[model samples]
Target chain A: MTTLMAWRNLRQDPIRFAATVIGIVFAVVLISLQTGMLLGFMKTSAGLVENAGADVWIMARGTSNVDQSGLLNESAYYRALTVDGVESVARVVIQFSGWKRPDGGMESVILVGFDPRTGMAAPWNIVEGSRDALLAPNAVMVDRLYADKLGVSKLGDRVEIVERMAVIAGFTSGVRTFTQSPYVFTSYNNALRYTNVEHGGASYMLVKAKPGVEPAALAERLGAVLTKEEVLTTSDFASRTRQYWILTTGAGSALIMGAALGGLVGVIIVAQTLYSATVERLAEYATLTAIGAGTGYLNRIVLTQSLIAGGIGFTVAAVIASVLAASSASSPAAVLLPPLAIATIGILTLALCAIASLLAIRKLYTIDPTSVFR
Target chain B: MIQTPESLIVEDAVLTYGKGEFATPALRGVSLTAKPGEVLLIRGPSGSGKTTLLQLMGAMKEPDKGKVSICGTPTTGLSQKRLRAMRLNRIGFVFQFFNLLSSLRAWENIAAPLDIIGMDRGAAEKRAKALLAEFGLADRADHFPKQLSGGQRQRLAVARAIAHDPPVILADEPTAALDTENGQAVAQILRDLAVKEGRIVVLVSHDHRLEPMVDREITIEDGRVVEERGPARPKSNALRSTLSALIEARRAASGDGRGGSGARQEGPRISSLS
Candidate 1:
């Protein structure tokens, strides 16, 4: 009966009800998209390390994250190979370099160098190229997304990395970095020739374990040879990378604060509207109570109305977010709609509405049946 | 005729609002007894505590220092839940404002008390239709309270109050919102419930026109009863005898007006009727 009454009451005033629902929907969509973009950017920041398929990462002593790692001796690769349950280890060099496309457009890019023969640490998701391409002299792979931005075309196109001419042999997918720069993968010797690094030295070591070897235990065993801040599992490396960008940089906090502000504004607007509606219909509620309705009934009615409005608003916002995400998929600030993010935004919006309507619920509970007469 | 016992008895009831220096007495030691098959009229000017007395009798409000019993149960010590149950099951109320749910139709309003008493919707609605038909509101059964006329609303209210067949009916100026004809029609319904069905009917009003419809009239002034008039007209013995003979003739012509002609008459028809 209470549910029925509440549904009837909402139907009684369509405009105000719709306004409340739309307000909530807008809030939900905005929050979800904002949070989704944040997560997407966070993933991009640690994309290489997160999907590197390596059991452990060996960086310089006192290294914070992969992007901030100092130079490490390439000898760390050989030292890791001698450990118990150790497998093949490869040296990986990462450095910022300038790339000049065939069309004469220049842009900053991250150059990743791996061994061509072993191909253990190569770009795993090639879109139009093979790892054997990197075996050729002065050949490199570019990310599919940034290839257009760099004004590069087919695999045979020539480009210059740090003034060293190279052929665009292929492209890799999902290799775009947090800096939104194009990624170029080359042979270790080519990277050394371009960056002028030592022949046996690199910035980090990508270590894969033998079968049945736990990454965490291997990382711990390797930590004794390296420092506590040097050796980390793939998961830890990715986590530290994301944390570095969030804490030291301004991106994470800004997005969160913006979402909070939007939610606060939405709650206040939606709550005040619902409260005013309740006050206007107070006499009707009192009449119901006078006729034998309990406080539980009134509470159910108010909450049901709030939830209905919230559901409508959240749905609208989600649809809007999806449309925006779809249109901006190729953009740097692409909105990603994960199911967990949607659910979280939904729960948050509902909580905001429920909390905002607290005063209205109290007012409903305090309505004296005798006051209707007055 | 079958004589049922009294269902409600109030003794020296005193209800006072506020306390200390602000105490305002609404009912001061007022005593009344309503037997089954009786219409008790409580009449007073505005602010004369007529409403307060009715509220007390209905157990809607408690008297500060007195006892009230309905259907042999003492209401003073009852919990609010118990009082509500008693109101739902044993006492019917018709307010002057009609108090019909604005969202419900005439039939739904009439069936509200029955619903409160836990009757199924189908059964309650069926009873409600019958009651509406009884009150000549069959055509208005599907109309909401806002769509009904003032008289129709009052009739609906009366139908709702009596739908559950409670033992006692407390009406506070049930006909005040209606015109003379509608008011007389409503009064006839109350009279039928009291005299024909043997239910205790207590009506509070300031209208002197309703006095003839009640079996007894009690006039109040400043929260106290000032005059009590019996059902019989004040007349000489010869006049009383002639009136009783006329009433007997009418009863015979009506063929058992009380609906039970096999039972013996207990007392004087009119003088002792009060």
Candidate 2:
């Protein structure tokens, strides 16, 4: 009955009702878009650790980012392999090197070297060539998304890494880096030729746990033996990397603030819309009172109206946001509207609508049944 | 097939609005009794507290002093919620403005009080349809109140009030905005409701022609009853019809008819002593 009355009241003025619905839709879209962008920002900040197949990473002491590690003694890799739960450990090196393109442009690139035997912490999402292509002489792999930025035209293009020339062996898709520097993937022997790491020293070790073994246990065991380096499980590494860029550097706070502002705007729009709608029908409400409707009944009708408007607005906004999210799949700035994100937006929208109805309900509580006699 | 109303009683009720130096008394110790199957009329000049008294009887307002009761249940000091429930289950109202909910269709408007009583919606709607047909508004069931004529809207208001089968019907100038024909038609319906259904019908009006239809007439002035008529069926149906025509003729001759609009002009109208 409340819904029936609410719907009828809404339908009384089609233009006003439509305007209210549009206002709500505008607010909802703003929130979803801002939140989606924030999620995209956070996901990109931790991309390296999330995409790594290794269960644990042993980085140089005080290494905050996977792409910015200091040199570590290569002997840590052998010590990690002796751990009871350790299956295989891959020797890895990462170093910032200047790349001189044939077009006479220079760009910084992170030269990533991983042992092909352990097959851990390597470039993924390959679109143009096999991972084995990196084994060729002077071979290296880069993401297609960064091809223009890295000054590469095609496979077989020659570029100088740290004054040493290398051939573009493959192109990977969607391997976007958050550090602005592009990743150059190659074999450990090839990487050593391009970086200044000391002989018999690697930047990091990627440790894989054995089947049925937990990565946390493996990390603890390696942590006890390798006192000079820090051992972190995959999830911990990802969290640390995200916190470093997002929280400490304030890279993601701007997006969070934007989402919050969108929410506030949505609340104002919805509250104003519902409030005006309630005002427009104050006489009708007074009539309801005269006809014996209690205050509770009046409140139910208003909340039901708000929910209806919000439900429609959220549906339209979610569909629009999802389509936008899917369309950004190939872009470096991905829009991630995951299931959890969608659910959160749903709860937030409904709660805002409930809050917005408060103003209208306050007006209803002031209605005097005797006013009809006047 | 006899029906009876829960008799209504108001004893020395007093009410005042505002505070301190601004206080103005609205109703002053007005007492009245309306028995089952009686059509009682309250006539008074503007601001005579007739409307305020009617509001008290409907449980819309609590008097600052004195007591109002329906079927011996005193309404003083009752919670607002309880007062509203009593109104929903026992009292019906007809307003001068025909305050029908404009958004709802005629049937929905009529079914509103029934819905408040927690009736099955389907059954409530069926009863509303039947009442609409009885009011000659069957074809207007799906039309919103704004889409109806003034007379039709007033009829809809009356139908809505009585839809829940309340024992008491209180109307304030129900026919003030209608033509003489509509006014007479509405009065006839209220008269039939009281006589045939044995419900208590009380109305406050300034128009004198409605007198023929009521069983008793109480004229009030300055918040007090100046005069009271007998509880007598003084006029026959034919006489009531004739009296309605005479009043319409008198208004037409006096130029108060307002170009055949049939609505009585606002303000005090002098009634013939006959």
Candidate 3:
């Protein structure tokens, strides 16, 4: 019965009801967009660790994150292989190198050099060409999102990395970087040549646990033997990388704050609209109160109205977020609206409206039922 | 059939608004009671606390230094929840402005009190329809409050007040918004509700025109009862019918006899007098 009354009350003033719904929709869209962008960027920050097929990562001692590792002697690779439960250790070279675009424009790129035979720490999603293509001399790969930005188009196209000639051997899909650089995949030997580094010098080593062996146990074993380097399980490495960008560089904090501000604006708008609606109908409410309607009955009416607004607003915002995500698929700034993100936004919208309804409820509590006589 | 109303009692009620230097007394040491099968009318100018006394009797507020009871239950110290329950199940109200929920149609508005009592929707609807028909508003049952004439809206408010068959009916100037003829017709209905149906009707108004129709009249001045008059002869239904017919004739002469637009200007006439 209270629900029916709420429905009727909202219909009484269609324009005002619509204004309230629009306020809710605005909140939903802003929060979803800001949060979606943050998730997309966070994914990029942990791209390499998440995609790497290795069970553990070995980096230089005192390395705070995946992107800030020092070069280790090639001996760390063989030393990791000697640990019990260690299957095959692959040496990887991750370095920042200058790249000359096809038009001679200079851009910084992360040269990820891996063993083409093992494919460890290599691009997991290849949109063009195959892994074997990296076996070719001076062969390298670039993410499709940055292919146009880096001035590379086809697999056979040649570009300059570190002032050394390199061919675009493959195109990786969705391999974006938080550091504002495109990852260029190449063979270990080619990477050494391009970066002009000495042989047997690697920035990191990818370690795979033997079948049926626990990666954590193997990581601990390698940690004991390799005192000069740090060994981390894949999960820990991903977390460390994400936290680095989110906490240290101020990027993560800024994105979270943006999302919070969007939510705050949405709350304020919904609160004001709902409060005004309540004020407009104060007399009617007072009449009800005089006739013996309890607080619970009145609460049901206001909350039902709020939930209706939330349900419609969520649908509108989700549709807009999905469209934005689809269009950004090929752009460096990806918009990610996953199922979890959609669900979170839906719940948040409901909560926001509920909180906004509290303001109206306060006014309800103070109403003198006798005022209806006036 | 209307159940008999339990006697409502107010004992030396004293009520004041504001505090200390800003204090303004609304009611002062007033006392009254209305038994079953009686129509009690309270008359006073604005600020004389006639309305305040009505509120106190209705359990809408508590007196500062007195006691009020309905059906033998003390209401001054009752919890809000309990007071609300007592009101919902026992009392009905008709406000001066005809405070019908604008969002609801006439039938829905009448069904509101029943709905609050958790009555089944179908039964409540049927009862509302019956009540609307009894008030000669059968055709306007589906109309919203704004779509009805001032008189029709007042009638609808009365219908809503009695929808749940509450034993005690509190009407604060139920006819204040209507013309004299419609006002008399409404007053006739209140008399019928009290004498014929055996329910207690307490009306608060400044309109002395209501004097002859009621069993008792209590006049208040400066928050105190100045005079009390009571036990008038109950007017016959034929006289009530004559007053109603006069309204209908005026309604018809003005236009469609529908009262939707024509009844506003048709104030009280000689035909309305018993």
Candidate 4:
């Protein structure tokens, strides 16, 4: 009956009810979209390191993240291979280079050079062709999300990077990085050919530990052999990469601030609407109090009402966010509505509504039962 | 300690609203008692404090001095929670505005008290339906308060107040908003609840038409009881006349006096039927 009363009270004014729900929806949507974009950008920052498919990464000294690393002597690969518990080491080259589109427009792209046979530091997901496609002469792969921006669509399409012509051998998905730059994958030899760098000028060394060997321990041992480079576990590199982008970049700050603002707006709207609703019907609540209804009963009613509004608002926000994620899939800064994000936003919305309800319930405590008689 | 057997009792209750010089008094040394199977009518002018007396009897307020008891339980120092429980189980209130929740239907309004008392929903609804039928409002069971007429609303309020079958029923101007036909009908229900159901029914009203239906009539002016007439006590025209003369003399004196007795302050008051 108390629950019914809550529903009836909200239903008493449909315009107000809709307004409250719209307020919650606005908040939920804003929070979800901003958080989703943040997650997307964070994933982009850590993309190569997180999916490097190696136990450890060896970068030049003073390296903060994958994108900010200096080049190491390619011989560091042989040094890591000679260490105990070392499986196999692959040399990688990452450099920001200019891409010449078919329309003669120039755009910046991160050129990654790895051994296609070992698949180390390669794109994790290929949407168009197999990873083996990189074996073709002068071949490179581009992320599907950034393919249009790079002016390439399908296999056999040709583009030039650093003024060297290359064929689009495959298309990778979800490899778009926070630089909003497309990741173009090529073989180590071809990357060296395009960038005109010496063969020994590898940017990082991807080290795989022997089965059952701890990466940190292996990295520690390899540190002794390759004193010129910094050895880090794959997880450590990924964490540092994510942290660097989140803490040092204005992109991270903007996304975080947007999300926080959305949450604050949502909380204010829900608090104000629920508080006004409570105040409007304060006499009714006091009437219940005078009739011997306990505070628990009244609280449960308000909570039930808030939950109802939150449930509807969350559903609406999730739908809008999902649509946004789908529509922005091809955009440079993709909106990522992961399953976990959806679930988190749902929980957050409900918690916020519950908190907002408390602000309204506080008014109930001040209501004098004698006011009913008045 | 022996306790009064009455369902509702007020013994020399003195209630004041503010403090210091701002300490205006609403009820001054008033007393009231009602036993089971009796309908007591309390009549007072606008500021005579009749509502305060009813509030005290319902355990809704505590007296500054003396005592107000419900079902023989002294309520002066009872905790708010305990008082709420006592009121829930023992007292029913019908307000002047027919304070039915505006959002609820007539029957749902009647069933609210039952729900609060933890009655099963189906049982409460069944009882509410029966009461609506009894009050000739069965057809208006699903109508909201706005859709109901003034009389129907008052009748529904009375039904709601008594829905829990509480031993004490306090109706403050139950019929003030209703027409004569509906006012008499609601009055009859209050009377029947007292006479047939053996509950203590206390009606506070300025409507003289309801005086004849009650088992007793008590009048108050300036927060003081002026007269009481019932089967238990002899009717006295002399007492009424003397109280009226006293009120005139007090009014005349206040005109020439530096400060008037603020006895006519508007608020709820408690008075006794002797």
Instruction: Please tell me which predicted candidate would have the highest DockQ against the true structure.
Output: 3
Candidate 1 CAPRI grade? incorrect
Local error of candidate 4 at A279, Å? 2.0
How do the residues B66-175 of candidate 3 rate in per-residue lDDT, one tens digit apiece?
Answer: 88877566788888888888788667898888999988889999998888878899999998897877787888889999998887888888888877666578999888
Report how far residue B104 has shifted in candidate 3, in Å: 1.6
Ordering by DockQ:
3, 2, 4, 1
Query: What clash pairs does model 4 have?
Result: B31-B272, B32-B272, B49-B269, B52-B268, B52-B269, B53-B269, B53-B270
Report the C-alpha lDDT of model 1 over B1-274, residue by residue, as the tens digit. 2222335777788988889899988889888787666788988888788877776677655778788887567789776666656666666777777877776778987776665556788998888897777777788889988888887788788778777666678888888878887788778778766665556789988766788888888888888888988864344677445434533443354352322221212221111000
lDDT of 3 by residue, A14-53 (tens): 8877887777777777788778888887898888888879
The CAPRI quality class of candidate 3 comes to medium
TM-score of chain B of each: 0.82, 0.82, 0.82, 0.81
lDDT of 2 by residue, B1-274 (tens): 1211246888898889898999888788888888656799998998899989998999988889998987556788899989998888778899888988877889999988988889899998998898887788878899988889887888888888778766678999988988888788888888865665556789999877788899988888888888899666955787556534533443354352211213212221111110
TM-score of each: 0.83, 0.91, 0.91, 0.90
lDDT of 1 by residue, A1-374 (tens): 44555666677778888878877776776687778778887887888887666789888777776665677775677778788977878878787788887778789888888866556557868989888878888999987778788877788988888788999888887665777566678888888887856888887788889899999999989988765338889999888888888667888888888788879878887778778878877876765564455566667768777777887788788888878877766765657777788888888888888887787788987776544331
Candidate 3: RMSD to truth: 7.5
TM-score-best of 1 and 3:
3
Least well predicted 10-residue stretch by lDDT in candidate 3 chain A = A115-124
Return the TM-scores of chain A for each candidate in numbered order: 0.94, 0.95, 0.97, 0.93
List candidate 1 stretches off by more than 4 Å.
Answer: A100-106, A115-121, A153-159, A173-176, A247-250, A372-374, B1-6, B77-90, B105-143, B162-165, B193-199, B232-274
Number of clashing pairs per prediction, in order: 1, 0, 2, 7
Positional deviation of residue A248's Cα in model 1 after best superposition, in angstroms: 4.2
Relative to the unseen true structure, what is the C-alpha lDDT of residue B137 in candidate 3, on a scale of 0 to 100? 83
Q: Is candidate 1 or candidate 4 better by DockQ?
A: 4
